[model samples]
Target: MTTPTIPGFTRHRVRVDDGVALNAAVGGAGSPVVLLHGFPQTHLMWRHVAADLAADHTVICPDLRGYGASDKPAESGAGVYAKRTMARDVVRLAAALGHDRFTLAGHDRGALVAFRAAMDHPDAVSRALFLDVLPTLDMWGALRGVSAAVGFHLYLMAQAPGLPEKMIEAAPEPFFAHFLDAWTRDADAIPADVRAHYLAASAAAVPSIVADYRASAGVDVEHDTVDREAGNKLAMPVTVLQQDWGAALGYHARGLWSAWSDALRHRTVSCGHFMAEEDPRLIAAEIRALADR
Candidate 1:
């Protein structure tokens, strides 16, 4: 799949461990900072913020495995798409780029991967930022009534493997476009060309994408449960930008994140789920703040 060129950024196919080669956009010259994209979109989602961050820091935005031009390995029934594995891919991707340690940020699905990467390899992540997401355990724990109804996609994608994949493959555009349109407060947040690219990329990666979501319901939860039981918190400074799901779901949003990070800065943004695209300046400023701290 072809990704639109981000001005001033060079693209590379960096091979991480497990034979996974990630399609990454690399630029900048200072401290290393990796930006991970979420579902239904490639690293292109970070175009604006990445460009801004590149002015002062090394900005590396990579298409997560099973998305965009990245390798889509078949599921090994071992939760290969689990955030733990995906997180490892990020760690190795950074190391391959000669960064033994780096600041990190992720949105949506990528946020989960960032969270895991921080938890599992605390030494490798200097500071972490999560955009519009909750821990797998908190996510499941918070779902009830209307919240559960709105998150139907989570359940739909978590179903038995073949069915979800088959259904998504049947009508790729509408299925993929649904999230882009529904999640964004402004439909124009994603332009026509970018939306088309997302739909096409998502259609091609149906099986792997579904597997990623499937792993969330299984192995991802198990990992989170273990972390919770162990009383482990992220060892780095963390900043979370969310959509005030707590207000909508009748819970405390920032309070939820505080449990997982000792150094926590959580705020609810007014943008849609695609906060980076909707408000790139805020996202970039937040990352810069984390780096400054």
Candidate 2:
């Protein structure tokens, strides 16, 4: 599938672990920063911010296991796509690239992975930026009324094994295109060509993509709950940029995150769920601030 082009970046595949390989676009030169894309999209989601960050940082934008050109192995079980494993894949990918410790950022489902990475590998992540997502537990707890309606996809994807995969595979384009269109504030931000790439990549990886989301409800929650009970929080500085959905959803987004992070900077951005695409400069600035920490 065609991927977005970042002017100074060159694409490469990194074998993160057995049965998992990440298709990454590597660029620039300096302390490494890995940017993970969320569902229905790939590393291409970071095109604008990656190029800007590439000016000083060794920016690594990788399609999380099941997306883009990355390998989409069969899910052995629910834990297969758990954020814990995905986090390990990311840590390995960074270490293989010679970065033992670095800054990290994720948008959407990617943000979930990045959060797990920070909690599981504190020393390895100097700082983390989470875009448009809450902790998985908090996310589930906050669902009600309109919020639940908007997050219907999460429930749809978190279904029993064959069902979600079978349904999405039947008509992947419209299924994938639904999110690309629904979540973006400016349709122009994601050009028609870019949207096509997202649809194509997602269509080809429906089963694995569904498995990834399914894990969030099962193993991902188990992991998060264990961490929460153990009083485990991200040691690194954490930056959260999200739409002001907390009040509407009957939540204090910052309060929830503050419980998981001592050094937290939370702010609201008036964009749709795809903040990175809607405002790359703003997202880049947040990363730069976190990197400076």
Candidate 3:
């Protein structure tokens, strides 16, 4: 059977960085919007919302550097998987696709990349939506004590090389499946085929995936922290959608976002972490609202 993809979208292997090519699905017309996927899944995670937006705008969904059909380069250094590098791949991807500027929407890890892109190259990103994530600098500060248990994987993958990659590769399926099973609020949202696709793809990407998380614990935090101290901020209109982890995590989600955005609309939702899949219509509508602004 052929792989499942967003209906009507055409796929392309676009090289956005040196020796790195991102597998992307591009469709629709009019102004452009790029959708970036979260962990343990491919761009297919944006299928529902992407299809909805394609009816009115050009939609481009690309698997991040180390995920899905994209090229997974060996982690020669901390910069390899840093979101800044990944974000540059995206800016170049849009330019290579003939768009000088586009609205962006990213979830989880993807959102973190989008967050950096908006900050570093504000002129190229017209507007953005970041879903279910805290900026890296803020995330480390937020996790503490027993409440931090929910993010055990973060600490696990953050360890120095060799060990983290070996531990995950030993039983990749179950290791990846744990998040797939735990994060979704509705099982029907992923379905069986999509879940299988995510597991298979993630299983094959253990090393690169571990490098991504490891960068989060090291270089990624450095980039965000340096920018934070410089007082760099997003120049575009910004929208943040998150499952209210504030009360349980002892931090205010809106307050954290406000520090980085002057034009921010932060919405706390009941939908699971994978809000794009669990509530596609709301996700699509929110993207439309933000893109329009």
Index of the highest-TM-score prediction: 3
Model 2 residue 75 distance off true place after TM-score fit, in angstroms: 1.0
Off by over 4 Å in 1: none
Cα deviation at 72, candidate 1, in Å, is: 0.2
Tens-digit per-residue lDDT, 79-182, candidate 1: 67999999999999999899999999999999999999999998899999999899999998888887688888899889987888888888989998989988
Q: Top lDDT: which candidate number?
A: 3
Q: Once superposed on the true structure, which residue ranges of model 3 sit more than 4 Å away at CA?
A: none
261: Cα error in model 3, Å:
0.6
TM-score of every model?
A: 0.97, 0.97, 0.99
What Cα-based lDDT does every candidate model obtain?
0.90, 0.89, 0.93
lDDT of 1: 0.90
Clashing residue pairs in candidate 3, if any? none
Question: Model 2, range 77-171, lDDT digits (tens) per residue?
Answer: 77678889899999999999899999999998999999999999998999999998999999999998766898888999999888888888888
Better of 2 and 3 by TM-score: 3
Quote the positional error of residue 240 for candidate 3 in Å: 0.3
